[model samples]
Target: MTLNWDNCPAVSRSSDVMSGAVVFAGTRVPVSALFENIEGGATIDDFLSWFEGVTKEQVNEVLEFATSSLAPA
Candidate 1:
C-alpha cells in the first residue's frame, strides 16, 4: 500500500520545494533519499553526514512513522 505522509511531522511538501516531493521538514532532501541510501548500503550516520540539514531526531521519527504504518492493527 502507498504510505500517506500527510500525518508525518518529520516531513513536509510544497509546490516550491522539490516540485512538491515529500521531503524532510525544512530541507530540500527527499524522504526517498533515506531509503535509497540505505538500499545502497549507506548507514544512517552516513546519510546524516551527507545531508546536514536533516536531524537525527527527524530521521528517527520518520523511521518510526514508516514502521508504525506497517504495524498490524
Candidate 2:
C-alpha cells in the first residue's frame, strides 16, 4: 500500500495556515489535536462534537490512511 499524504484529502498543510501544520482541510484544527484528545481518553464522538467542520467521513479517511500506512508492506 502506498503511504502518501494524498490519500487523505481531508488533511492538508499550507505555509499560510497555522505555520504549515497538518490541519483539517478548510479549518485550522490541527490533526494532532485529534490524536491528543483521543490519547487522553476522548472518544471519536466526543471529538466530533467538540470540533465542528470535521466530518466523520474525514476522520474515517484519515484513520484508514493511517492504518494502511502502518500495515506491513
Candidate 3:
C-alpha cells in the first residue's frame, strides 16, 4: 500500500522539489533513499554522513511513521 506521507512532519512534497517526490523536510533527499541505502548495506550513520541536510531525529520520525503504518491496528 502506498503510504500517506502527509502526516509525517519529517518529509514533504512539492512540485518545486525533485518533481514532487516525497523527501525529507528542508532537503531534496528522497525518503526512498533511506531504504535504498539500508538495503545496500549502509547504516543510518552512513546515510547521515552522506546526506548533510537530513537530521537523525528526522530519520527517526520517518522510521517511526513507517513502522506505525505497518501495525496490525
Q: Estimate TM-scores for all models.
A: 0.94, 0.88, 0.96
Question: Which tens-of-lDDT digit does each residue in 6-73 have in candidate 1?
Answer: 99999999999999999999999999999899999999999999998999999999999999998999
Between candidates 2 and 3, name the one with more favorable TM-score. 3
Model 3 CA deviation exceeding 4 Å by range: none
lDDT for position 9 in model 1: 95
Q: Which digits, one per residue and each the tens of the lDDT, describe model 3 over residues 42-65?
A: 999999999999999999999999
RMSD of each: 0.8, 2.7, 0.6
Clashing pairs in 2: none
Give the lDDT ranking, best first.
Answer: 3, 1, 2
Query: What do the candidate models score in CA lDDT, each in turn?
Result: 0.96, 0.84, 0.97
Task: Output the better candidate (1/3) by TM-score.
Answer: 3
